[model samples]
Target: MGTDETTGAEPRATLEGFLRARRDRVRPEDVGLPGSGRRRVPGLRREEVAILAGVSTDYYMRLEQGRERNPSPQVLDALARALLLDGEATDHLHRLALAGGRRSRGAARPERVNPHLLRLLDRWSDTPAFVLGGTLDVVARNRLAAALHADFTVTDNLARMTFLDPAARGFHRDWDRSAAAVVAELHKAAGARADDPRLSALVGELSLRSTDFRTLWARHDVRGKSGGAKRLHHSAVGPLDLHYESFTVNNADGHGQQLVVYQAEPGSPSEEALALLGSLHTLYPENGPEAGAGTRTGRA
Candidate 1:
């Protein structure tokens, strides 16, 4: 395991941290075990997890303590079953175990959206489309997307806008759900590249600044942004119920760029509202110094 350069102490292994967090979320009765007596911890005891996973208590302890880093696939599967982890979380577990404290080899370069992709986004004049970099940075966005997110003080990063921007609560009708999903998506990305300095810095900033972010981040939930519905209260449109789809950009650079597009349901009130928003933008185009002045739209 790697040691912290400043402290000269070993950092907690990623696999160990993930295992401990997941273990703390599994209740005794969740896996058909008896929940009879009072316990010091919130979730299943370590020994109980061992029993459920069909592993020795000592071995399980070693796994949690980072002393044992190379568990076989069978053991990983058993542990996933024991913890009742979902598909995404199970995959995250396998990734952490496979990483085994190895840091990424080279420094990361700034992500650039392909010109072709930018043109594609511009073609969707009525839709809100943007490209998100590996650390959830808004690398490129169409005019509609820019207009939608005009309320944010900093639109460069989605995670920052979601947690730090004061407008986030007002924009996202379901603020709590939005917060949890953002944290979980960031967790999944961070898990894949544990040593990315940008991710580390962003996580640290959010953890220090937002109490809600700290709480959700500690849970270690892992999920990707695929497709979902969003309920938003736009400053101009009043209310919008939009569905969004995310696609991974298959670039040779492997920077994990994602193309996200948002649309309203056909014939719904939200569709009318969206159209009105588009028309408003067309009539009063935000150009020069006035672009992205006082509007508010959130990333779903």
Candidate 2:
């Protein structure tokens, strides 16, 4: 989502741009209205959209114009259904609405993990260690995570896969449980930042596209994703039952970043598989000579 001439760096304008683009794609006839004469704005009228979404024309106008940034989850959903956005579009909208002030998408370009922490991953090659966001976006994963949840990182979001990806249906042994977790994380984000325009748009898009998402969201389940057990069927290692621990890193700037680690039982085939992954990880070649090894802190 690119911003334009007058838009600020607050991320609100990018969301506005997306909404305007989607708003343009839908013709009047697509939603049961017969085409009349040449019109200025392409799709539905402001009043029509506002009425359909159960919002005031002035407020919706401000939203479309990027003047207003706060819209509740329910209002965003109403707008999404009215716009007829697909699952991916819906998720994008939600991410935008929940992004707060962060500009670039997908977790502020993803802060790099510490070298020592990465070393830990290198050591535990038989285990799975990856960083996942509150949305279960597989931020980064080691060899074992790639093996266990093969398709997790391929997509931008876990919820998007639950609705759109074919492999998700097959790969996730407990599909319902996975789906519930996805929705719960999304709900938590929504609760945390009720005014994020991007988050609002994403929720709207998902609700319109997937009936399953709609049903799950309606349950009002809110929970943070931290630790859990995942039963994985690796094409190479067969089946593995592993427990996971997910914790947030205290970014120097106070951003809530997390590091998720997964481990298998000792003397298990999963552990052996992890070892193979570690061996492979050690050969990655990018673990070059430490560049900033000699910095000294001044005494207070």
Candidate 3:
């Protein structure tokens, strides 16, 4: 790769800094490596790391210095083991590798909302529901999600539109909780991909647009959003209270992608309200995606 000597802010430098910092924090005493003499550097040397990680000393040195950014999965795994990384830290290593300004292998396609999943969504056509990705992208939605959150997809990103969209101002009954959830999810994603360009780009956009997102991001909250509830205001359907559940379908093909679905409690007013919404979908099937047809996704 040709070096752009004039570029002052390089992403690899940030990745290099992270790698070196992680290297410096641990000593030979920590992982049973031999420390023969008093060390001059703060952390293990290039050769020490290489030995522990089962890599060539020269290659390890090049990686730490940001000269070789594309380390294979096996190599990364070995390095993580050598570094004694926990689960979260290991995930962060991948994120850092992706974010280190290196183009990664293309991501698997956005999951298709399968017929079974769509049928499940269809079963609750009255419920205000949608599916969200880890990055807060609106992957799928029922009619109610669209009616209540009209500008949600048009704004391109869920987190951005949630905090910055004018429609969202009154749509979400609880802004603080909603904001926290979004930021928390972002925090968790960032840890996994400290170097992901797309994620970094989204965070940068949110930081510029919404102070609330920036503040929450600084808190370093990690959230694996399995489920939650929200009260929504729809111009057509009025107000409806609903609870949602998220399931991460095991995409053997993809890294970490999840599909979220929502439901209303049985026998409650929301449930009754949801029933009414289901009726509308059956009668007015032409309103949603594929015009009364639902997309199926995942094995579930």
Candidate 4:
């Protein structure tokens, strides 16, 4: 992501900041522009971007300055191409442009998990499953999911755990890659929930407290919940390799939640590890990793 002076600014200001940040990240050579040693600013200049995007420099400047709030879809598509944005980044750009309409109406209400969804999680005792809210908060989880993530003192927020928790380095076998991915996903979520106060507070806290998180956040990377593989080192069960699938939970409530389920190969060592973890969960139902931890409610 590109950087601009958007802290505490409204949706329009945030839109500006994102554009500047992304523009700063693109080098002259990156977009086939000649690298001039006499350049004064980092990344491509505003004129350069305007030229590439096939728009007037003044018009493009207005977009970043918040003088122009809406651009035609064709113009936006051109800007996206000029910026070399991927699918996720392009989607985020569109959301920011539209967020102004929603942000002015009112803040969004907090999200809650469905009771039926909770019951479904309980029934999947063999599989580790959890639900994540917009802020990547652990809103709901099965016993196995709790056990899988029990090593962390705070299982409520995944982003905090990845950056602030010391155990995260060992827990995630590929810490750097996972950390980057988590940061990117948070960026994507924030774009969708631009007016959510909770999201703002979380971003602020992480930016102030963790240097690594601050660095990643500035990159303006955007990613959504998707299927992937993870290698984990559990405190009790040792090493385990698992694959995960993420599903969007769509219902009348419009919670916009993601259901993430983890599974291991049937005859693999990871499967054996999962069974052992399950047994421990059963034996120490009261003192286990997620013992008595109720589901999280409200906005992240």
Tell me the tens digit of each residue's lDDT in model 2 across 95-212: 5555534443333333344556556655555566655443344445555555555544334445675765666766667778878888867766654444545455556656666677
**How would you encode candidate 1's per-residue C-alpha lDDT over 1-300 as one tens digit per residue?**
343454332222277878888899988888898778878988888998899999999999999988997999899999999999999998888888877756565557757667677678768878888888888887777777777776667676888899999999999999999999998888888667776777776776776677788778878888999999999888887889999999999971787989999999999999888777777665432221222221223332
Model 3 lDDT per residue over 1-300, tens place: 112233311212144554666687678888897767878987687788899999999998888778987888888889878877666656666766766555554333444444555566555555555555546665566665555455343434567777777777577778788888887677666555554556656676666666676656544445667777887765555676877777775642343555566667788877776666555554442224532222222210
Every candidate's lDDT: 0.78, 0.58, 0.62, 0.78
Q: Compared with the true structure, what per-residue lDDT tens digits does model 4 show for residues 67-105?
A: 787887788888899989998899888887877445354
Model 1 lowest lDDT segment of ten: 287-296
Give the candidate order by descending lDDT.
1, 4, 3, 2
TM-score for all models, in order of appearance? 0.88, 0.51, 0.57, 0.88
Query: In terms of TM-score, how similar is model 4 to the real structure?
Result: 0.88
Query: How many pairs collide in each candidate, listed in order?
Result: 1, 19, 10, 6
For model 3, the superposed segments whose C-alpha errors exceed 4 Å read: 1-116, 151-156, 279-300
